[model samples]
Target: MSKKNNKIYLDFAATTPVDREVLKVMMPYFSEKFGNASSTHSFGQEAIAAVDKARETIAQCFNCDFSEIIFTGSATEANNLAILGIVKNVQKFHIISTKIEHESVLEPLKELEKSGHEITYLTVDKTGLIKIADLEKAIKDNTILISVIYANNEIGTIQPIKEIGKLLEKINKKRKEGGLSKIYLHTDAVQAINYLECRPDWLKIDLLTFSGHKIYGPKGIGGLYIRKNSPLSPIIFGGGQEFGLRSGTENVASIVGLAKAVESAFNNKVKNFKKVSDLRNQMLADIIKHSGESAKLNGSPKSCLPNILSIRFSGLSNETLIVALDRAGVAVSAGAACSSRALAVSHVLIAIGLTPKQVKESIRISLGKDITAREIKMATEIINKTIQNLL
Candidate 1:
């Protein structure tokens, strides 16, 4: 729990404060070392070198070639690039994604539908896990891409990406034998990158997208890993930067900060995973102890990311609880921060079979690496007490 002037931030899924080390390394590039990476002069050369190093760092972290990693403005942009980029200029095709995907992926898929592309929106079980059989059945001959969220942002239920990837690999081999176009597998790993296996071989994915801010890096920078031969066209065309796939002047400072943050987080993944999960488990137990029958935890605990908890308190309002918690100096959310502004119930919760009334009763409490046990204890008390007061 990080409290400044009595405020505890529990919304790590939305974004994270930039790590101190990442900030330290980014300082020079913002001032003395600033330069346009596209320029041909020494300043530009220096800036481009930093960019290359950042790319190399990401490649090493995700176990991909340097050329396969493409930096973007945000994970939203990366998701757009991976989804729209692959099927660009094609006559017609099909794609598959989950009902629980972030708007970044869902919106693009929706747009593709307007352009005559077929999309299959797979449903999830009560625990928010997609069925592999459903996905296997959704494949059409022209199905070129399948984009799934590696871990849902709201409920934090991790989809079986490895199983899906292996299924694709086998299907692709037979498709090759049959002379059909390859069906690329893309996972929006923005939420899963911090706590899951991301190696391309391990997941058997053709494309993976993640955000910098989600892992304690600065905002405005994200990364995409494209397999060596994936056919992706540029959605943003300008100066032909980023190996001609994403064209724009590189954001040197955020790029370096992203790399440093990713390297640090990826290296400390096991330790951080255990610590955050332990804190979250303890907090869950405490919250459940108090709320008991009134509280219902929304997703599979075993399959979740350990940091995120979506819970509903019977007969209480999420909006009211959110206000009460905020007044008490604890920050939380009703659902994905991206969709928090909307009045409608979360599409994610609905897909998992939550009623509109239950959706209004639910709130999300996500933990960060900086959170301490004391903070969790305080937060648990505050949350339960707030519900009692509301009741």
Candidate 2:
């Protein structure tokens, strides 16, 4: 057994600890190479070169043209820019999204709805998988966009983006007869990039958004990949930074860190995924073995990400489990940290058809590269004991 520590972090889905090497790369940008990338002097030239190198690395990770990547403040900003930027240019716009999308997607759609845009939230199955047929039927002439998450953050369900791409290709072909408006496909790929195989060119996504923090990079920096010549209006207007798409001075240090983190993560994606997934599987097996009939898996068993595991307890509440685990020196979450404070049931859980009781009883346990098999074993033991005592 490993030495017992009071803090076992398994909340990687919410965010990750920055890699030491990434931090090392970002250090000089903050103090030594500190120059506004927009400046014309030699100092600025170095900063600009660094940012350009980062941008190219990001593009290579997505296998897209370097010019297509636009750095933004965060994935939330990227999602907003992608959705609002596209919809603003069209009249009577319509969008198709899953009911279980991250609030970043749902809230923007809500704001758009309040602004008078029509939206149809496609329902998901019990496993949290959205139906492609539903998506197909929802595509109307006014459907300006379809924004689906590549993989869910809460439940770790991988959506059928490639299948949807094929469906859209067929629909786009037929819709050309009536001069139908071209439907743009966008995916919030923040959670899917490190954990899944995402080929934007093959998937035919018009826009893809990802954040650096989610993939073990610095927070507050992300990028959106817009297919060449995709019609998108600028949400923020200022000096022509990021092709005048995002107007700001740019967080040079964070951007540099994000780029390095994304590059390194993608480079080691396959090996990292296998390592994390093995730890997660061990934890899941232990949870079931210890908790027996009371413990159950919440997300898609087969088609989900290797890192995230949302477990449901039949009798105990999430709060109890989290508190008990924390006291025992294990850290987990009931859901997204953004919504962790609310005592209400998660919208993702509700969308997946879990009862109010089941939702309150559920807690999300996500793993990262830092998590070891020993840590997983300790966490599961704490969780089991917590549930037993709560009952």
Pairs of colliding residues, candidate 1: 1-371, 1-372
Error of 1 at 98 (Å): 0.7
| TM-score (C-alpha) between model 2 and the true structure | 0.97
Give all TM-scores, in the order shown. Answer: 0.99, 0.97
Tens-digit lDDT string for candidate 2 (171-263)? 888888879978889999999888776668888889999998998899999889999988888899999799889999878899989988888
Worst 10 residues of 2 by lDDT: 1-10
Off by over 4 Å in 1: none
Q: Once model 1 is optimally superposed onto the true structure by TM-score, how far is the C-alpha of residue 62 displaced, in angstroms? A: 1.1
Which candidate's lDDT is highest? Answer: 1
